[model samples]
Target: MNYRKLALTLAVLALPGVANAHVGLHTDGAMAGVSHPFSGLDHILAMVAVGFWASTLGGRARWIVPAAFVSVMALGGLMGIYGVPLPMVETGIALTVAVLGLLVAFEVKVPTAAAAVIVGICALFHGHAHGSELPEMAHAGGYVAGFMAATIVLHLIGIGLASLRFGKAGLIVGRLAGAAVALAGAVLIAG
Candidate 1:
């Protein structure tokens, strides 16, 4: 993969004001969706950690876990769009970041199926948040697609970082990143 290009793309996408300036709640649904994940530190950390954890697992998990998250998250989004009430949505999202970060930091090894299930649960909360916040005028299909694309990119970033092949040192670096994510989650919960 072209790391430079990927990094550049992510940098561009992560620009803070672009989405807000162009895609308001009543504006372009696609841009709004794309911008949503990057707008919140909580969403970014959890999505990236999901990728990092999947890579740490190192196998079929490299793909299955992320896929499961995306699929299940979309389902959760539908629930939100349809006005299904999920209590503690914010708490669930915060907990997801904390738990996923801890999983990455500790290098917890679990079966691929188990990992998928865990990530799937996290995705539900995230998707619900997305759904609930969607603008009334935004096209649902376009919005979902935009967010899903952004999400996949974040996951890919995590996978790329973990695949750096620095051996033991790389593992340490990954753990540190995970720790940072966990710390951010804690701050989110506390604040």
Candidate 2:
């Protein structure tokens, strides 16, 4: 992409309208859930990073890692709905973003089970944030479905990107993207 295109894309992404789409909008159900994942940069980055890491692991991990995240996320959401408190939720979320990104950058290949566990722990923080912010009037089931669907889409995107092996250049690009994600997480932590 040319500099102009890159600048435009970044500018569009930085727009408040895109980032804060969920703010002040009162949706009765699934739409609210779907929008929530896209609303926060932290959620988007971490979820995608999970996918990227999974793809790097290859084989069964492609499915297992994401499955673990979604499954555990649901449990975390339930805990949030029931008002179970988890300390430093925001901090945890931000830290996961950084850690996940680094995992992708380094192409770390832990055992599939271990990767699932790590991803599951990260999902809890994300899922709780989603659940705790549920609108009183929204249908809980629909909202959860929507958010999970959106999250799946994000994961697919990351997997698709990671699956591309355009020689060493592609590998370098993937690493660079991971580093950028890590930097974003650090910025989130600072902010």
Candidate 3:
């Protein structure tokens, strides 16, 4: 695969997404949805880690893991939108980051089905967070689309990076990044 093209595509896609400079500024649901994933460090780290881990697993996992996450996360989002209570969402999100990060760092191997289940579970917390945060005026459909698109973009980025074969040094760098992500998760848990 052309890593440069993938990287370039990701960079271009990211250019339009502004950070949460003024949270309520986006009156449009699509904008809000797209921007929400980028709003938090926890979300960004966890989502990227999911992609990275999936890539490390390789073969069918690269797609299946992320696909499971998005699917299950949508269910969680619906639950959140309808006022379904989920205990300790914040903690779950943080924990996923640490878990996914560790998975990447250690280059852990598990069956494809198992990886999907793990990422899918983690996605619930993330989806719920997104759903609960929906603005009253924003259309649910648009918001969901936006967030899902943003998420796919993030995953593609992680996949792209992991796909790059930099020999030993590249592998080391990626693993180090996973470690950093894990450390960040730890801090998030503490904070």
Query: Which number leads on lDDT?
Result: 3
RMSD each, Å: 3.8, 7.5, 3.5
What tens-digit string does per-residue lDDT give for candidate 1 at 85-179? 99999989998998999999999999999999999999999999998888788888777877787888889888887888498888788888889
Arranged by lDDT with the best first, the candidates are 3, 1, 2
Where in model 3 is the C-alpha error above 4 Å?
A: 1-28
- Per-model CA lDDT versus the true structure: 0.85, 0.84, 0.86
The model with the greater lDDT, 1 or 3, is: 3
TM-score of 2: 0.85
Give me the candidate number with maximum TM-score.
3
- Candidate 1 vs. true structure, TM-score: 0.86
Q: How well is each residue in 1-191 modelled by candidate 2, as lDDT tens digits?
A: 36346435533433323344575664545777777889999999998999889999999898789889988888887777778999889999999999999999999999999999999999999999988988888778877876777777677767778888589999999999999999999998998
Which window of 10 residues has the lowest lDDT sum in candidate 2? 10-19
Q: Which segments of candidate 1 are over 4 A away from where they belong? A: 1-28
C-alpha lDDT of candidate 2 relative to the true structure: 0.84
Question: Candidate 3 residues 1-191, lDDT tens each?
Answer: 87567657755554443654666766657777888899999999989888888999999899889889988888888888888999999999989899989999999999999999999999999999999999898888777777877887888878877988489999999999999999998998897
Error of 1 at 102 (Å): 0.5
